[model samples]
Target: MQAKEIREVSCVGAGVIGYSWALYFAMKDLSVTVYDINEESLQLAKKRIHESLETLIKNNVLTKEKSEELEKSIIYTLSMEEAVRNAQLIVESGPENYDIKRQMVEEMEKYTSIETIIVSSTSGLLITEICKNAKHPERFIGAHPYNPPHLIPLVEITKGDKTSEVVVEVAKEFYTLIGKEPIVLKKEALGFICNRIQMALYREVCDLVTRGVCTIEDADKAVTYGPGLRWGIMGPSLVFQLGGGQYGIAGALKHMGPSANMWLADMADFKKIPDEFAMIAQEGVNEELKNRSAEIGNDNASLAEYRDKMLIELLKLHHKL
Candidate 1:
């Protein structure tokens, strides 16, 4: 079915990610049903959704009345049958266990229509493995969204070995309709794109700290005040192209290729974390948190609010909002 033909979307597992997905669909005026087994989790998801809507209103992204109307479009339920009933799309954000996700797909297939597209929010697990037990594996695909799906625009649409090309296109259209930048992977890979890049950078950061090259706070400051700013505007390849001065990427590669290759060869290549490194990493994080706690008061909710606000303003500057 075309994305425009999809009116109802089901969100299985109403945690932070699932709830954010539901909120995004609701804001787009699509009907959303969120299903969770735990009553407390459902309540918490409702509360977070309300708070998120208020944040959007305060940021001038939506009017209060419109936000209220959108909120009403989301229906919370415990019954899997009710959740998938009439749902054109189902986004699964349950636990990350392979067995659990496979089982969930098997169960969802029993109720959902044969044509309904089911996507998983898994960060690293292979979509082909996750859908192995699916009744209609052709209808299964991976739609991994970055955290806070309501705010983030990038959604990685990955295909399993058995996923149909038509299903991938439909999923891409669906995410685009809901105001997301959907990137389709030609082939499936663990961690998709964003997380893979994230881990590459994180690995270097950890290595640097372990070697006493810089403190965690200093490393963070370097990112926030340096390349991170440029990365926010454009990707590294483009940045390198510009860094080439009048010659562009060709000249830059010719001049720096040897040094870059040397650095790459010398970079950390550890397959497993050492116990000492783990302890140091934990201590460094604690120290950084303690330092920030003095000024931020250690309230996670407040920190998250601050983060979302900053992200919204950045999006606005980039003409994304």
Candidate 2:
């Protein structure tokens, strides 16, 4: 069945990611049943959803009345059977452990219809490994959303070895219909796309600070005030294409390839965070947020609000909203 025909979606696990998925589906006018074993977590999920909906309304993404209506569309339940009974799509955001995910998939298979499309919100785990014990692995896929899934537009839809092309397409269409920018991966790889690129940049950032080349604050400013500004407008590849002048990417590479190769060779190759660097990183982040936390109260929440607000405006400018 086509994604547009799917009216009910079940979100397993009421953690932040699952709750955000529930909220997004509800906001798009789909019936969402969120299942979690913990009542307290469910309550917290409800609270966050309410708070995020208010933020969305404030940002003009939704009317107050519409937000209220959407809030009602989400149903919280502790029973997995009840959650998946009528669901056409199941989004599982349980623990990231392979064994836990494997067990969850196996249990969910017992409750869901054979046609139900199951997807995981795993960051780095392979979908094939997660669905190894599934009765029907072809119905399973990976639908990794960035943190705050409701706000982030990108959802990476990846396939397992046994995941059918039709299921992948349907998953992509489903996410797209719910107002996400869904990119399908040809094959499963660790960290998918964004996270891999994100970690690569993070590694270099840590390397710079660890080497005393610059403070964390300076590194942040360098990105935010420099390439980051253009990055928000276009990806690095396209930016380089523009840098190529009339010759585009090829010309830009020809001019800068030697210097780029030299820098690449000198990049850090550490697989884990060094102990000394970890201390420096922690201290730097704390120092950066100290004043901002005092001013805004609840540093994380305030920063998230600020992020969502800016994202709404940026998405609007990009015609993504």
Candidate 3:
């Protein structure tokens, strides 16, 4: 199906990701139906949907009136049939477990046509495995959105072994139409794109803290005040192109490679997280939180508010909000 033909969206599993997807689709003026297992879950999803839009409203991304109007576009349901009835796009934000996801598609296929595009919100599970038993695997693909989908623009799209190229293109176009930045993987990779890069950096942070090279607070400050700042505006390669001055990325690499290679050689190489660092990182974050002002948030809820506010301002600069 064409992107323009995807006028109705079905969000299965009404957790944070699912509801946020519903909110974004609805905000873009698409009709969205959210399905969950029970009233309590759907109710929680509704509350979260409201609160997320309120964040957008507070950041001037949406007026209160407009947000209310957008809320009208979303409907919550417990019935799977009701959810997928008229949906051209089914965004399954269920569990990350392969078996559960596999089962979800089995039930979903009973209700949806082969023409309906099914996109799993699995973080790292291969879509090929997830859809192997499906009646219509060709329409299935993986679309992983960064947290708080209404605010974040990154959605990594991965194709299943049998997934149609047309399905991939239609999904990409639909996400772009709703103002999301979608990247498609040519070949399946563990953790997709952003997660690998994020985890790689995080591994170094953990390594530095464990080795007593720096405190968690200092590492965070370094990133927030350093490359993270430039990265928000432009990607690292583009930033390095400017950093190279008279030269480009190739020049920057030439001048910076020796020391970078040294640092890389010394960086973390472990596959799993170091066990002791969990408490170490938490303690450091708690200590870091103590230093923050109330206006910038000293706790989880307030910090989220602070993050969404800043994110909206940044989105505005990019002409996205």
- Top candidate, metric TM-score: 3
Tell me the tens digit of each residue's lDDT in model 2 across 154-184. Answer: 9998889999899988888888877799999
How many residue pairs of model 1 clash at the backbone? 0
lDDT leaderboard ranking:
3, 2, 1
TM-score of each: 0.93, 0.95, 0.98
lDDT of 1: 0.88
Point out the higher-scoring one by lDDT: 1 or 2: 2
Indicate whether candidate 1 or candidate 3 has the larger TM-score: 3
Candidate 1's residue-wise lDDT over 1-321, tens digit each? 887888999999989899999998888888899999889989999998999999999998889999888887789999999999689999999999999898889879989999899999988788889998777999998888988998888999888899999999988988887778999999877778988888889888888898889988788879988999999889988998999999998989989999999999988888665667777877776677677753343356656777788889988887666
Output the number of the lDDT-best candidate. 3
Off by over 4 Å in 3: none
- Pairs that collide, model 2: none
On a 0 to 100 scale, what is the lDDT of residue 125 in model 1? Answer: 87
**2 or 3, greater by lDDT:** 3
Please write out the lDDT profile of model 3 over residues 102-209, one tens digit for every residue.
888998999987789999999999999999999889999999999988789999999988999989999999899889999999999999989999998999999999
Where model 2 places Cα greater than 4 Å from the true spot, the runs are 290-298
Alpha carbon lDDT at 255, candidate 3: 92
Candidate 3, residue 173: the lDDT equals 95
